[model samples]
Target: MYSFLENSTDIHIHCCPHINKRSTDIFEVIKFAEKNKMYAIGLMDNFSNTSGYASLVKKNFPNLNLKIFGGLIMEPPAGGVSYENAKISLEYSYFENDGAKFISFPTHHTRYIAIQEKRKLDYIQACFYVPDSGPTNETTKILELIANKNVVLNTGHLSPKETLTLVKAAKSLGVKKILVPSNNFNKTTIEKLKIHNVYFEFSYFFVSKATEVPLTHIDDESHKIKGLTLKTLKDLIEAADPKNVILSSDCGVSILPKPHLGFYQFIKQVHELGFTIEEIDYMIKTNSKRLFRI
Candidate 1:
């Protein structure tokens, strides 16, 4: 285990029992976190609620030292963005007297991106979206639930306009904890969003080319794949300011290394890029703790 990882937490990690292929299972991820003396890890699935699975793990592993949490992705498979689905997920996530810790808007199944990429999935009607006027009554109701529960809100794969609108609404609703993937928007948008105090999640997966997961439609030639190099990542962190950022592996695809190993390499590279240990820890450790309130 790397010294920098001591007491760290990764708020975004993909693991098995997923609709798509993954490199590791929940058990493998847990063992790796415990082995590295990590404080916590949040499990994310694009198509379902991982809160029930996380609850089961906690119930079965009573003596485990590390905290394991899970969240829901508001996509078609999870019942889309609705108050009912979020309520049910939270109810089902109960473990150790707490419910699900986070709730994300749609990622791959977002209406904006799905239409943009010309995806042919049958559940396109169920894809999540907010009107140009902003969140609808139902969406605002769900945001209220998220705020009342104090769960982290993740801006998943929405366009810059949609993300900004949603973030502004979530903040107004008293949703204190929010996370946005840094790669989803440009530096100017990121800097604009900084005023809301949302945590920017930086992942090494953006730089890694190996993945069995389909990031784009087969016929979408207009969409070219791009990734951030180490220097770009450094610039993004500096742009967002280290205090409001969190580092995640976003690993677990069949071809990528397991989350822990990939994360080790991520921090190592960030260190080599002239980020001080204190800065790295602030992003990977302190920000995570504050966001999740662990």
Candidate 2:
């Protein structure tokens, strides 16, 4: 294992039992994390809440050293941004064991992007969106729940404008930890969002060539997606303070490398790009520890 993998934390990763194909199952991911001496890993599934699965892992592996956490995504299949659903999901998490550490607003099914791309999926009966006015009553209630629980709030795949609005509202509501996916914002937006004290999550998948292909069976136009180069990722990092940045694999699709390998490669690439180990550790370990309160 590389020095960086020791005590490193990855807050974003996909696993099996997904609606789409994944390279590994949750158990495999957990085993790998433990063997690599990782600090923690968060499980993400777009169609359902993973809190229960994380609870199962914790129950079965009481002796393991690694921390395994799960979260909810506000897609149609996961109850679509309702306060009731969010509440139940948190309750299911059994937070004492590190379950439901995150509550992500919609990702691939974000209404803003779905409309922009003209995306149509059968399971997606509805898409989640926040109006220009701000979060709805239901959303406000969920935000309050998040603030109360003190879990991470990930701004998944929302349009940059919507993300900005959501972040402002979440901050005002006393939500301490907010996560924004890097692909959703540009340099200017990154600068703008960082000022609000929200962590920007940069995924290795975006820069890998494997992302040019469809990650799941339903994704047909992925080949048309433009992949971000290493230089661009470096530039994006420089756009914000290192303390506000997070590095995650965002890998698990069958088309991509396993999450751990991809994460190691990501760290290596960033280091080769002239980032000192201290700076890389700040993004990969220090900031992550702060976010997860490890």
Q: Using TM-score as the measure, which candidate wins?
A: 2
- Give the backbone clash total of model 1: 1
Q: Could you give me the TM-score of model 1 versus the true structure?
A: 0.91
lDDT of 2 by residue, 164-226 (tens): 999999999999999898864679999888889988888888888765764442244442344
TM for every model, in the order presented, reads: 0.91, 0.92
After superposing candidate 2 on the true structure, give the runs of residues whose Cα lies further than 4 Å from its correct spot: 94-98, 120-125, 217-226
Cα displacement (angstroms), candidate 2, residue 108, comes to 1.5
**Cα lDDT tens digits for candidate 1, 1-294:** 359667989877888476446788999999989998988988888667888888889889999888988888887667778889888888775454466788888877777777766656764555777778899898899889999999889988888888999999999999989999877567889999999999999887887775323443212333433467777888888899888889898887666799998888888887888888889989889999988887
Candidate 1 wrong stretches, greater than 4 Å: 94-97, 120-126, 211-226
**lDDT, candidate 1, residue 280?**
90
Looking at model 1, report the run of 10 residues with the lowest lDDT sum: 216-225
Pairs with backbone N, CA or C atoms under 3 Å apart (clashes), candidate 2: none
